[model samples]
Target: MHRATFMELCDLLSPALKRKDTKMRGALTVEKQVAIALWKLAMPDSYRSVGNQFGVCKSTVGAAVLQVANAIIDQLLSRVVTFGNVQTIVDGFTALAFPNCDGMIHGTHIPILAPEHRGDQYVNHKGYFSMVLQALVDLKGHFTDISVGWPGKMHDTHIFRNSGLFEQLQEGTYFPDQKITVGDVEIPTVILRDPAYPLMPWLMKPYACTLDSSKEQFSYRLSKCRMVVECAFGRLKARWRNLLS
Candidate 1:
């Protein structure tokens, strides 16, 4: 991150990360705490390695990582990850030839160390320990909504059904209850999904079998537009190299 951006983050996290020095030792500054956490997240390094570089013990590094992470989620997550200006998002997707589309929904597996308890639950279809990160990617390739840390053994359809986004969409509370008529079909604002997901009024998926030219064209357009989410995932893992493993 740029220096200005990092400083701004420190300011935002100060309320939660600020600490007082005790008699035993001087407290770590909020900047140092955030740095430690970011380092751990950006690098595939061990707690001992991070502690050595930061001039602290492994326990301190671990504590700082957890504290800073919790602070970011509690203080910054809602502000950054949000469904902003729904109409604008719809307009953006409309320009891309998918009318009344809100966003693209997809799930990616994030590799993780197997937990001691119920480790098998984290083993995915690929037979590896992982967690699921299901995200809603907007037209501009930003994450509007994310459901992280679901067990990898679970399917994308299951994760989406259980998500808060699913509830809102199902109740007609997520996007405006507006419809656009395409021929005889009146389509509501919907997010594009893969064939693994079940079809819904607010969610669309490619046809299992393209029996005609029209169905093939529809599936082609949906697949082409849905590439945004795949690119977003690539960028995420690229920037956060720790997730590559």
Candidate 2:
């Protein structure tokens, strides 16, 4: 994070993370708490290691991480991870040659320590314990929606079906009706995804595995448009090394 961004985050989180100081011990400043938490997240350091660097107890470091994280999510999540105007989203994807596309949806596995019970459920096809992070990314590679905490063993289709996004779509509360003409048919605005997802009025996926030339071309175009989400995930894992492992 840049210095300006760090200070901005500190400003946003301080109000919630700040605590009253007592005679027992002066409370750590919000800056210090956020710094410790960011360091812990940016690096693979344990609570003890982070505390040693900050001249604080491991327990204090752990608490600071949890508190600061919750504070950030509570205060900043909606602003940072918003789905803006539907037309704007459609335009963004259209500019990239994907007409009527509002977003690209995908899932990535985030490795994590196995939970105490039912650890086997977290073991993925890659032979590692992980959690699934399903997300919808706009053409600019920003997350418009995200769902986490699903076991890695679960299929992407299963996770998507159980997501709040799916519920909203089912309830007809999400994107307003918008149509685009393709040949003689008018198609509703939709999100792009891989074959792992089911086709719906608002969701578009490529054809199943096939050797037909036209199907191959369609899959190629869809994959090209969907590459934005993959790049976004790659950058996320690269910037946050802790998430990479």
Candidate 3:
């Protein structure tokens, strides 16, 4: 991460991460704690190795990591990742030839070590222990919404249907009450997904059966828009190499 970005994160997390220094020892500054957590996340280093670099023990490194993670989620997550400026997002997608599109939804598997309890549930179709991270990405490849920690064995469609996003979309409350006319029909803002997902009034998916010229053209356009989410996941895993493992 860039130094400026790292400092900004530290500033945001300071309130959550700050601890009172006791008589026995001085509390680690928020900067050091953030650094400890970032190192552990960005690199595949062990906790003992990370602690050695920071002149702390493995336990301290583990605590710092958990503390920083919780702080980020509490102080920064909702503010940074959200649906913002609905019209702007719609315009961006329109420029890409997908009219009335708000975003793209997709799910990816995050491999993990098998847990002691119910580890079988984490075994995905690939026969590996993992979890799922379902995300909605805007045209600019920013995550507008995300749902994580679902067992990897769960179908992507099942995960999406159970998400709060699904509930909001189903109730017609997630997007603004704006509509545009395409031919003789009017359509509200919609999100694009893969064929694995069920088609809904608010969601668009590519055609899977025999396709005519018009259907093929529609599917091609939808696939192009869906690439934004694919690229977003690619960039995320690339930057946080630990996620790949």
Q: Largest lDDT belongs to which candidate?
A: 3
- Cα TM-score of candidate 1: 0.90
TM-score order, best first, reads 1, 2, 3
For TM-score, the strongest prediction is 1
**Please, what is the whole-model Cα lDDT of each candidate in the order they appear?**
0.91, 0.89, 0.92
lDDT by residue for model 3 (1-245), tens: 67998899889999998889999999999999999998887666889999999999999999999999899889989997988889999999999899999999999988787889999999999999999999999999999999999998999999999999999999999998999999999999999999999989899999999999999999999999999999999988786664435
Compose the digit string of candidate 2's lDDT tens values, residues 57-98: 999999999999899889999988998788888887777777
Stretch of 10 with least lDDT, candidate 2: 236-245
| lDDT per residue (tens digit) for residues 120-234 in model 1 | 9999999999999999999888899999999999988889989999999888998888899998998888999999999887888889974598888888889988999999999
Positional deviation of residue 62's Cα in model 3 after best superposition, in angstroms: 2.9
Q: Is candidate 1 or candidate 2 better by lDDT?
A: 1
